[model samples]
Target: MKELTKQQSKVLACVEVYLNKTGFPPTRAEICKELGFKSPNAAEMHLRALEKKGYISIQSGSSRGISIVKSQQAFEKNVNQMPVIGLVAAGSPTLAEENIEKRIPCDPSMFSDSFDYFLKVKGLSMIDAGIHEDDLVAIKKTIDVKNGDLVVVRLEDEVTLKYFKKNNHNLELIPANKDFSTIEVDLREQEAFIEGKSVGLIRTH
Candidate 1:
């Protein structure tokens, strides 16, 4: 977990305890009351910091909307940096000038595999795999792929994230969520290519 400041640690502790006891995260007002803060804004600051540091996720438009994603530290800034790709335009390469949002400094050792770039996920097709829209999926560019690997692939004009499996000339792009169906492609007809494989993911700050 990211090292929290003394006050942030206290607020996080309070939230953990409250969530454990009540099955829900405490509201900003409740957090302030518990920590004896002068106002909710003070608590909000700490909460936002926690979220940014990848310790929690805050759902908008609701009170007590904090969800503990995990007690893990995010990538620390280092010499290595990578581009973050936004919504990919159809028929364009993944690394096209129009696709990249910006680059951020990151520690190369954060994930087991070194990543070339970060792609901003576009939908909930991989939600069951814990990858949601707007999340940055670490991508390692390569055409050499294996079955059952979470991958970012290009299907003609579209780039999508899915589990990959290839057999003969047929390829299956599987979705983790039940709401979506698996995409099957034939190498002989439809255009498809492996852009990269997902090495890891981090929420958008």
Candidate 2:
């Protein structure tokens, strides 16, 4: 709802990622470390401004309790110049901040819809699908999907990448690894959420 300055947005974005990881907001010092601020007070100043403008809120006496208050709809529509890091899980959601490796510039037009962020691949889990470690997976931040699409999903609260299949009410996640078994879930038995579908890929070797 409120316009954030470039610095404010940068700091807030980092804070949001960190919060997703630790389940607690970052301290001023931690924020400084991530943003290259010379002093904790510099981070404090930015945090205060974000709070004053309604972008975030501070919980008294809590070290990691800063909360981001932006709406998902607004975030998707107004994402201008936001750095795309990698992809997050759709079948298995990983909100952990440490998984976010680096920031890469992206043209959001490459995706069919809005995406909140990107997750860097860490292993060869999807090598057969051409998704390698250190690759950047571009995901449109939406839940709607179809068969044969690559998706990031959270299974049992852990983030995973896979191709999706739906038959009646049975959901299946096919892995790229031949050694791995396909994960099947009954919508009535387990809860699964699709973070987004893989729209594009970035590779650097």
TM-scores, one per candidate: 0.58, 0.55
Q: Best candidate per TM-score, number?
A: 1
Question: Could you list the CA RMSD of all candidates, in the order they appear?
Answer: 14.1, 12.3
User: lDDT winner among the candidates?
Assistant: 1
Stretches of model 2 off by over 4 angstroms after superposition: 1-100, 111-114
Which sections of candidate 1 miss by over 4 Å?
1-79
lDDT of 1 by residue, 1-205 (tens): 3567888878877888787778888999899999899898999999999898766789988888897654321223223556688746475446644465765667645899988788888888999998889999988888878999999888878888999999999999999999999999988998887888988898855
The superposed Cα distance between candidate 1 and the true structure at residue 112, in angstroms, equals: 0.5
Q: How close to the true structure is residue 72 of candidate 2, measured as C-alpha lDDT?
A: 25
Error of 1 at 91 (Å): 3.0
Model 2 has an lDDT value of 0.73
Q: Tell me how far the alpha carbon of residue 86 in candidate 2 is from the true structure, in angstroms, after superposition.
A: 6.7
Positional deviation of residue 105's Cα in model 2 after best superposition, in angstroms:
1.9
Summed backbone clashes in each candidate are 0, 22
